[model samples]
Each structure stands twice: as structure tokens, then as C-alpha cells.
Target chain A: MIKIYILSIFLFTGFFVNSQNLKPEIKYLQIINNQNNKFIINDNIRNAEICADSLFYRIDTYNNDVSSFFLLLSESYYLLKKYDLALFTLLQQRILFYSDSINIYSKKLLNQCLNKTNKKLPASFSILEKSLDTILFVNSAQKVDFLFSITFFINSKNTKHKLLNLITFYEKYFNQNVSFGMAKWKLLNTAGINLKTQTKYLLINDFNNPLSDYDNQDLLYNLPIKLKNKILNHNT
Target chain B: MFFIGLLLFFASEMFSQDVDFYIKNQNDNFDFQKMPKEMSFDEYNILSQSFRMQDMMFGFFVPGYVHFKANDKKTGYALVTLSSLSYATFAYQLVWSKNNLSDSSFFYNLNNLSSLSSDLKTNTLIMGGALFTIGSSYLFDIIHGKYRLQKKQNAIRYKYSLKASLSDAYIPNKYSNIACFFSMKIYF
Candidate 1:
């Protein structure tokens, strides 16, 4: 009986070891990390792309670690000035990691990639707007930041009307019984700035105006004065 | 001893690579998906149907049943409150009759008819019936709401394939007729 027990234990140990070996190995992780470091820290785009591609080709698409590997591959493509390929790879990653912070990062990177390719700014603004709308109920600060970023890209007359409507929505929200949290204030200020910038751009027709030209002067100096006075009167 | 400990560690590490652990750890990462805001079509249909059934059954007797179905909360509350007050009045009259019955003087007087006046007895019966009807309707609404919520969740996760087809059907003694059919294939 003792001999049989000993034999069974040996068999179990051997099977366990074999099973461990059968599991897909992340042996490429260290190599991918090294390549990423070389690209990010040393700024050697060509060598990093070669190394990343070689390592990435060894990885199967169905592998559990494929997303991470693809992220590195996309980063390499971005460093290599291959914006289109980078955008495509990030989009693929977004499909796999839907509604993840990694997807958000991919979107930010996509915006940058599109900007580099000289695609229309409205398309990028639309992406931000969609993300903003998605996270509106969950994260107010992120929603405000998205609105702030959108203000930079609103150039045409039609988009300006849309922005005006958005500003009014925020203004009404702030004026209502809703708690005036930091995010609300930030959103209001962003709307004011957007209005001022749009007015300046429309009146001057100069997109290249320097920031120093408007120093110490409120761009929304005239628009919000009445609202501010009303608020002050209510407080007093 | 060191070798055994190392073996145990390796075994645990290998065990931790199981699919459950992988999924649990993956879900721990931050997710940015939006919460669903609007009622689905199935949910809307269920609510509206529940409202219609209540209207058909009790709209005349129950004043705010239709309003409640239409999502007028204030009117619904007012009707429910009135029903409750009527039920309370019936209870109070029953208690008053019980006290009168226990009073020997009133029982022997032969002037009062069975300790409760005929008008009060009739009013109590009407109130009781109205209360039962309104209460059952409210209870049905609650149960239907719960059932619809569960069905909505299931519908969100359920996968379905819908196929619609149109074909020509031959008639024995007349022109060919057009036939249309819808096929729904659902996977749970």
C-alpha cells in the first residue's frame, strides 16, 4: 500500500509539472518591456519597432496577453510616426477592452493620431463629446474637462451655435437648485472662455492671435457681467 | 524544507492561473462604460400593458387608477389616500358597532337595528369593496413592476436573431396571395 501511494504521488507531481508547462507562457513580457523601454527612454523608434514586431508576431491573437502586447505594438507604431496604423491598432484594442480605461487611453491616442494626420478637428471633438456624454452621470469632472477641450475646436458658425446651446444648458444647471460643486463652476468658466474665444475669432477672423494680446482682460468680460451681478445681488 | 516550500509556492501560482482568477482580476480593472438611462422597449410595453389592464378592470370605481398608469404620481397618491381613509372609516364604524353590541342597554332598547344603522352598514360594505379592489390593483402593479424589471435585465443579456420573410402562396381557385412571416430565434 505504501509503495502504491508513493507511486501515485510521483505521478501527480509529474502531471502538475507537465500542466504548468502546457500553459501559455508570458515569456515575451520581458522582451516587450525591454523594447518599450528602449523606445520610450532612448528614443530609438526604428530598433524598437523591429523588436516589438518580432515579439508581437510570436504572440497568438487568442492569447490572454494579446491586448498588452498589442498596446506595446501600437505604441511602437506611434513612435515610428505611423499614426494611421497606430490608430487602427488602438481601435482593435478598444474592441477587446470596451469601456475600460485602456479604451479611454486609446481614444486619447486616437485623437492625437487623427490630429497628426490632419483629419478634421470636428471629428476629434465628436469623439470627446461622445466620451463626455457617456461619463456624464458617473464623473462630473471628466464631463467638464471634455467640454473644456471641445471649446478649443469649435471654429465654424454652426458649431458655435451648438456650443452656445451647451453653454446655456450649463448656465441653467448652475442657476438651478442643483448644488454648485467645483465641477459646475469649472464648466461655467469653460463656457465663458469658449464664448469669449468664439467671439474673438469671429470678429477678428484671425486664428493665429497670441494669448498675450488678451492678458489681464476677461474674454467673457461683457457676456457674464450681468449674470455675475445677479448672483452678487442675490448673495447680498 | 526549502524545496518543499518552493514546490508549494509553485503549485499555488499555477492554481492561481485558473480562468476564474483571470476573470476576477480582469474585472477589478477600471471600466468606463455608461449606465443605461432609458427604458427599453420591452419594459415600456410591460408598463403600458399593466396600466391598460388596470384601467379596463377598475378605471370607473378607482378614480386615479388611470392617472397612476399614466405616471401621475400625485393623483395616484391622492386616490390611494382617499381609499385608505374610507377603509379607516369602515373600521371605525365596526368598532363603534362592536361597542354598541356589548352595551346591554342599547341591545335591549329595541330602537337601534342590530347596533349599526342601515345607512352606516351599507356605506361600510361599499368602502370595503372599493378598498379591496384598489388595494389588489396596487399590489398587482408592484408585482408586475418587479417582474418587468427582471425581464428587462434578462432581455439585455439575451441574444436573439430575427428573420422576416415574404413569399407568394398559391390559392386553389384564385390569384396567388402574398404571405409574410416573422421568425424569432432566441438564445439563452
Candidate 2:
């Protein structure tokens, strides 16, 4: 009876160990990570594409440790200049990891990519990042707050964008100097103008209209004035 | 449609003789105005026959008695009529209600069907309300069935765990099992 009991114990222990030792059956995470790390350090587009392709192929079945894997995959795809795929992967990560604390890193990666591309960012990213930046920088130091506030206003839905631009314009004058935000707002307005001229069609609801409940006209007038001054400077 | 066709067939047969006689008399130059206004036997038979047809087509579907253990069709018919009468009375009370103004038009339109001017509207509201109640009961039954099935499934997945007590005894407790068996499926 004792021998039989010992045998049963041995069998159970062996089964538990075997189950625990079983690696992820479809082990693509490590392979993708190794390739992405190499690309990150060396900026190798070819290796990044190979790994991104493999990662994309298994996206449907991926459930464990999703946050880091998709972040790396998104950066890797962006390195390969696959902007559309990078955008799609980042959006998927947002959908899956929206409530996760580590989503900050994903948002940062998205912002980095958007900054590198010099055109109108996707409306979805603009709206999402605006909310994210506001939450993240709402209680930071004044300098960081000012920087983030400017970024948030510029990236906010067009109406809020105009309001923030106005607030920041007067803010710079009162603080006694021009700032990077003043330049960035000029860039945003130029892009908005270029978009209007290039495309005959406009969304019936242009997202850039000023807020409906603005109690301050002085703040409202400042944004267009700054943008107009920037355009005049450029022509002269 | 078949019943109406059958009714018209019988009606034509009963009326054919009187109609033929009237036409024949008129063609023979006889003055028919002096005749009595009363209908002939054949004409009366045809006229009375139609009332029977109307009763057969309309009233047969209305339940005469409530049988608890009767067939489904009979039970459904009984429930519909009883529920319809209750709803109609409730609707009438609501429309004529002096305490509240809300849903006044709704109740007024429904109750106004008894007034010949709104017969169509009254019948529609009653029939619609009856069917709605029947459908709600059927859907509730289906949802209840699913809930019972889920309970049975959970019962099948329960397991008992043994816990050691301070008195050197063990107690058995039941819990729902959490582990799921994974399978990968591919369709060609």
C-alpha cells in the first residue's frame, strides 16, 4: 500500500511538472522580440519586416502578454516605413489595452510615429491622444504642463484645437516671448489650409470649428491672429 | 377564401330561381309593382344564408370555453380573447380617465372602435395588443429555457474540494471549476 501510494505521488508530480514546463506551443513571441530588438538598435528595416509579417500572421490567436508584443511589432512596422500597418497595429493595441496602465507606452510610440510623419494625422489618433495627454499631464509641473497643454490643444478635435490655440497665443504674449507651440500652431494652420485647397470636399462638420460655449472672444481672436501673422511672415 | 367561395356558391343556387322568375315576368310585360314587397322563400333563404356564413367565418376562432389542458391552438385562442377583453376595457378606462392627460389619445382611439366610425382602428388595436402579449409570453418561455440549460451546464462543471479543519477533520466544499480545455479549430 505504501509503495502504491509513492507511485501515485510520483505520477502526479511528473504530470504537474510536464504541464508547467510546456512552452507556449506556438512560440512566435521570442522570435519576434529578438528580431525587433535587433531592428530597434540597428534600424534594420528588412529584419523588422520579416518579424512584423510573422507577428501579423498570428495576431488572431495572440492573447497572452499582448501589450509588449504589439508595441514592439508596431515600432518594428513603423521602422520599415509600413505606416498603414503600424497605424493598424497601434489602433488594435489601443482597443485591446485601452484600460491597461501600460497603454501610456503605446500612446508614446504612436505620438513618436505621428511626429515623424509631416502631414495631417489620422483623426482617430488626434482625438484619442488628446484625451490621453490631458489625463497624463493634468497634474505635472508647470513647464511640463505647458508643453503637454500645447501638444494636447494642437492635437485636440479641431474646435477644441482652435480654443487651445487662442488660450496659448495670449499666454505666450503675457509670458513675454514666442514659443515652440506658436510655431507648431502655425504649422497646423498651414496644413489645415493646404488640406482645404487640395480637397474640394469637406466633411459637413469640419472638426476645426471653435467651441460652441466660448465666453471669451479675446481668447478666440488670438488664434487666427497668430496664424495670420505667421502666414504674413512666410510671404514676406 | 375557400369558405367565402363555398358560401357564394350556395347563395347563388338559392337566389337563382327568384331572380329568373322576376326577369321572366318583366320580359313578358307584366307589372311587377303590384306584387308584395315580401321576399320569396328562395330569396329569403339566400339572404339568411349569408349571416350564417359571416358567423362561421368570424366567430369560430373566438373561444366558447377555457380548457386548461386543452390543445395548444384552443388554449392560444382562449388566452387571446380573454386578454383582448381585459386590454380593451383597460384602454377604454385610460382614454376616459379624468385624472391623467397622458396617453389620452392612445386610449381614446382604442376605445372609439365600438363607435362605428372607428371600427377598423378599434379592431386593429385589440388584435395588436393580444398578439403582443402572446409573443411576450413565448419569448419569456424561450429565455427561461436557456437559463435552465445554463444552470444544468454549471452543475455539470462543479467540483468538490477538501479543506482541513483545526479539529483534525476535513470538510468537503463544492465550487465551479474554472479551467477551460483549449482547442484550435481551422476551417478549410
Candidate 3:
């Protein structure tokens, strides 16, 4: 009778323990916190190594049931400075969902963005944009759009299209009064050298030079004559 | 279910061969072994989070390879057997589809010509074969999502079945059990 009762207790506690084990959501939150605090956490290579090993251990124990694992893995790899692995791992997971099931919305979108940034894979901008166009797909689309815009802004080749995509995405799905306008300005400034429009290029170039108030100071700063000429033309 | 599992396992194993071949034939170069284990700390953090999300949260999570005890010896085997099975099943379908292509042109020309063109018949068979292979593999991937769950269950079982070790090392909370501890033997 005692053995039977003890066994029941054991079973109940076993269930309880597992029920409280590191949940996928909790794990993901921890990883995000780590990323935010990486400057502190990364002060020691030993600490970084410890965290990396811990993450790998957790990943190895993960069951393929969680939808977020692939995302978490991608993030973890990114943190480890393993850009190729992070991108490749995400691609592998995306292929699994794409070639297998319909529940591949986020993975496919993220894959598209990463592929574009890496320039290792083909860009499916239309497919990503089309999916993000839906209201019901808002949550997934927003998360994916954020990644897309960040990747696009960083990429040197498709600055115009990337900015346009971000602009369109924000204008259509997000509030116009938001900080996305700041992102637009940054993009324009970054890609300003290639701008064909004289006014637009000057606006960016003036912001970069910032020498209208003092001429001798600008000369001492060795500001380029062509840039000074462009600035003068814009001011006049 | 066991037979189905077995069937799926072999099928996926077969399919992986075709996928491997196709991926190889595409001339897209990648050396998986040469790739870095970890990148930026942020990237590592994300990959870890993604893995946990994929494996532990929504689905039965399984690592690719895990240690299992068989006859008192630690043996590492693939935790996700279904992945291998799906590959095998896909392979079988690919091979089967390749062999069953109908010579439509030969039939179309039967009423007009006395002989069928050998090259046309051969090409049709080859093209059909390739499509069948690709189509079957694609289908196998779709069908094997559930099998992936089963593989995760097997991994948990394998973890539980390991023999108890002697040392009672207190592992760190931040680190995973897998890499938290190591044993050192000292002779004084």
C-alpha cells in the first residue's frame, strides 16, 4: 500500500517537474534578454562560451514540435557571430516547412529577408510582400517585415528597392507618424550618393557636411570643394 | 505503426539520396563541415532560441544525433529517425516514378509512323522519371512532419535510459546539462 502511494506521488511529481521544465517561450525570452545584454554577457569569452554551450545543449534537447525553435536557433546562431550557420540553419528549417507544410509563414518570410541580405539565395520580395499585405497575417508579417527592413537597409545593392519596400510596408500596415520615417531618412542618406535628383542629393550631402555657418572652419576641416559647391548651390 | 515507421524511415532515407543528388547537381556549393559552429553572440542566441522554439514548444522536439545506451555502451544515433525515414520514402518514390513514365509520343505517333523515335521515348522517360522523383520527395517532406514528433519522443526516451554516473557534480543553471560537466581522473 505504501509503495503504491509512493509510486503515485512519484508519477505526479514527475509530471509536475516536466510541466515546469524550460519551456520554449521561456527559453526564447531568455535568449532575447541575453541578446540585449550581450555587451555585459559577452565581457568574458568564458561567459560567452558558457552561454553558447548552454544554448547548444538546450537546442540538442529540443523537440521539433515548437514553431519558434527555428527562429530561436537563427537568433542564437546570429549571436554567436556564425552568420553563415545562422542563415543556413534558418534556410534548412524553412525548406522543411516549405517543402512539407502550410505552417511555414514566418520561416518563409524570414528566409527571404536573410537570403536577400546574404545575397547567397534568390530574393522573393513579392512573395514576402504579398503575405505581409494581409491583416490576419499582421503579427507574423510585422515581425518578418522588421527583419526585412533591417536587412534591406544594411544591404548595399538594393537600397532603393529595400527602402521602398520598407516605406510601402510601413505606410500600408503601420502608422505614418511612427519612427519608420527616421529609418527612411537614414536609408536616403546612406544611398544619397547614388541619388539622381539634385535637390535630394544636396539635402543629404549638406546634412553630412554641416558647414554653412563658417567658411574658414570648413576650409580648415578640408571639406571637399565639390561637396562645398553642392552645399552652396542648395543653400542659394 | 511500427511498420509504418519502418516504411517511412526507409522511404525518407531513399528520398534524402535524391535530394542530396539534386542539391549536389545544382552546383550550389556549400561545405557544411567547414562552416563555423557559432557566429555573433546575438546570432548564437537567436539560433538557440529558434531551435528551442522549433523543437520544444510546438512540436515533439528531437536533436539530430543523441547518445543512447545499448548493452551498457553509450551509442550515438539519430534522434529524429523520421527525418531519415522520410528521406528513404522519398527516395523510393523517386525511383518508382522514374521507372513508370508513359511514352505518350510513341503512342501519338503509332497511327502515323511505323517506328517510334528512340530518343523521344528515352527523353520522355527521363523527364518523367526526374519529375516523379522530385514530386515524390516533395510529398514525403509534407507527410513526415508528424514523424518528426515521434523522433523527438524517442530522443527523450533515450535521454532517460542512460546509466547513472558516479560523480554528483552540481552543474550550473545557465549552462545545459550536456555541456555543463566533465569528469577528470587524477592519480596521486
lDDT of 2 by residue, B1-188 (tens): 99999779766755544422233434533533221122244322232221123222222244321121112245445555665675566566454443443333544556565653454464446555755664554443334433433433332222001001211222222231222222333446
Tens digits of per-residue lDDT for model 1 on A103-188? 56666777887777664544544564466434425343234334434343433332333343434544454343222222233333
Off by over 4 Å in 1: A1-220, A223-226, A230-236, B1-122, B159-188
TM-score-better candidate, 1 vs 2: 1
lDDT (Cα, tens digit) per residue for candidate 2, span A1-236: 99999899878867654433112211233343455543232222333333333333332333444545556657666666655455545654554323355676777876776666443554554675666534333322222223333334233232234334434544543443223334344444544545332122222122333333332232224345665455556644
List the global CA lDDT of all models: 0.43, 0.41, 0.39
Candidate 3, CAPRI quality class derived from DockQ? incorrect
Tens digits of lDDT, candidate 3, A1-236: 99999899879867654433324333533444465544322322332233323332232132343324455545555565545545543543343222233246555555655665465332443455445334233343343333433343343432344344444544555444223323434333443435443223323233234233444323223335675454445444
Error of 1 at B32 (Å): 22
Q: Best by lDDT, which number?
A: 1
What lDDT is reached at residue B125 by model 1?
A: 58
* True C-alpha contacts between chains kept, each model in order: 0.00, 0.00, 0.00
Q: Which 10 consecutive positions of candidate 1 chain A have the poorest summed lDDT?
A: A21-30
Q: Which ten residues in a row have the lowest lDDT in candidate 2 chain B?
A: B158-167
lDDT for model 3 comes to 0.39
Candidate 3 at residue A34, lDDT? 64
